[model samples]
Target: MYRILCVASVMLAATTATGGTLDEVKTRGALNCGVNTGLVGFASKDAAGVWQGFDVGLCRAVAAAVLGDPNAVNFIETTAATRYRVLNAGEADLLARNTTWSFTTDVDLKVDFAGINYYDGQGFMVPKALGLSSARELDGRKICVQEDTTSAMNVAEYFKRYEMTYEAIPVAGTAEAQSLYLEGACEVYSSDASQLAAIRATFAAPADHVLLEDIISKEPLGPVVRHGDDDWADLVRWVLNALIAAEELGVNSANVDELKAQGTSTPEVNRLLGLEGLMGEMLGLDADWAVRAIKAGGNYGELFAKNIGETTPIGLSRGLNLQWTEGGLLYSPPFR
Candidate 1:
């Protein structure tokens, strides 16, 4: 009766199951990473057609860890709607897109989030001339929201709770939302705060637009992989943890070689760098995996500062993304 009653759910899980992603990726000679179609600061191609961004850094790090070559990655473009389809079909070994880990996707859809790489929040961007100080003031206005994302539902719930109404201008992706917003088709564009900052930075006259001081919903964005693959998930999870731990332990790309060559007094750093334990062998990778990963994209803070920090065009600060030592949410587990 159990099998009969839950046959549909079982079948769904079976279809999406990808258990041997590590072996598959190794056999294929490259890591197939799913990324956003075009989110400038998170994932986008540069002028020479090289993928570079915060999320792309994760992909490269994973590639370096698993395949021993950072450049051995094929970035498959996926939209908000088709990201899961591509991942489940086994076309992408991992997804480093800026996806929010929600209950529905986690429990119901059976997606596994490796870890939270970014702590984001829902926000609204409006023209500076609008002079809107809060999202509460946008009653009955047209708001551009990307379809098939948490932003849509969050915006709806927020307006309903505040007893306000607005016409939602649904868009398929960030580019469309940005275009419609710039064309004045909508008074406001609702999205993640990081994305809003990224989009605003790309505008010709960035000062013309301003993000409201409102952060309506918590969005813990992270890397995602399919369920039923604990081995692959652990590898990915530890790679992320290694980066975060590197940041906390002061093992950066600049000093990784020296640390690995001469060794460290910190036992956790030794274990993390594969100098004191069989951590990498346990993951079916060589001992130098974490070192290669950190070298590929530096530590977590380095990736952030390089891709989207205050100096970059995206100009994102390490608000909640700082290390746990500094009272932020980024705390990696002990390498031992």
Candidate 2:
């Protein structure tokens, strides 16, 4: 907890180096969100060319909070190699991609991770025919990994620490890596477990592949913004917190209006729903900001269940993503 505070303090200080992003975004009348090039269940276009997924849902929520219109956003597709460059260059306003938050990215890249929306870990996937049940079994094998990502670094460190030597087959993007892995360009593929699951679900024979039961590195993925815009950063962070708190407070899309109309004795719920607090005004928004956001696409859990839950093609169970009361890591701070 102390370490987390230290990191947050450093980020707060580091972000003081720039300013005025909120006014700029408001003036533009739309939020430009940077997302993955084509990672299914996170950010991918549907048949209608409309971006819809977990990450995309966050972008929409932010748009709704700021502009009162969830569709008032332009999703800018970014590769692992270009996400930071695009953000720092001001080409994108906020990056809601499944970007991992690390010390290097936070301090060195001069960007801030608003908050963690997904807690993931690195893992490997291989053909079921390999007869390998553990990552330790792959002593010397060719591995496909995406370049310019923590996956590449974590896998390298894992092999080194385990005293194993393997050839690295680097790919520029997820699509290329999937194609190569499917074509037998590499014997194994290493990435976040969620990504491996999402990718494997798209394969012709998903059951033919096996995700090894080994978690290599901690990956806290979330929304990112450039430095020098503390107000915008705070707004982004709190908007996410609003969604999370809404879920925890039992205020979802279906009943937000009803709850708001009836009024609540719960202070937290009232503050969250803009019922009896200046929370929205404090963020330079109208009282119904969170209402708009929640109405945009339900709450965080709803977005998750809709985009990548057990019923979806991604088929991801809310293992580490469940609310705190449900014994997972998701916890929202007090709205007051």
State the TM-score for model 1. 0.95
Which tens-of-lDDT digit does each residue in 1-336 have in candidate 2?
999999999888766543467677789999999998878898899899999899998999999999999999989999989999999999999999878999999999999999999999999999999999999998889999998889999999999999999999999889889989999999999999999999998898989999999999999999999887788899999989988989999989999999989989898888888888798888889999999999999898999999999999888899989999999999988888
Taking all chains together, each candidate's TM-score versus the true structure is 0.95, 0.94
Best by TM-score: 1
Q: What is the C-alpha lDDT of each candidate?
A: 0.93, 0.91
Global fold similarity of model 2 (TM-score): 0.94
Question: What residue pairs are clashing in model 2?
Answer: 18-228
How many pairs of residues collide in model 2? 1
lDDT of 1 at 326: 99
Lowest-scoring 10 consecutive residues by lDDT in candidate 1?
11-20
Displacement of the residue 152 alpha carbon in candidate 1, Å:
0.8
Worst 10 residues of 2 by lDDT: 14-23
Q: Per-candidate RMSD vs. true structure?
A: 3.2, 5.7
Q: Compared with the true structure, what per-residue lDDT tens digits does model 1 show for residues 1-336?
A: 887869988877765544478888899999999999988888999999999999999999999999999999999999999999898887898899878999987887777999999999999999999988999899999999988788999999999999999999999988899999999999999999999998898899999998898999999999999878888999999999999999999999999999999999999999998999899999989999999999998999999999999999898889999998998999898899
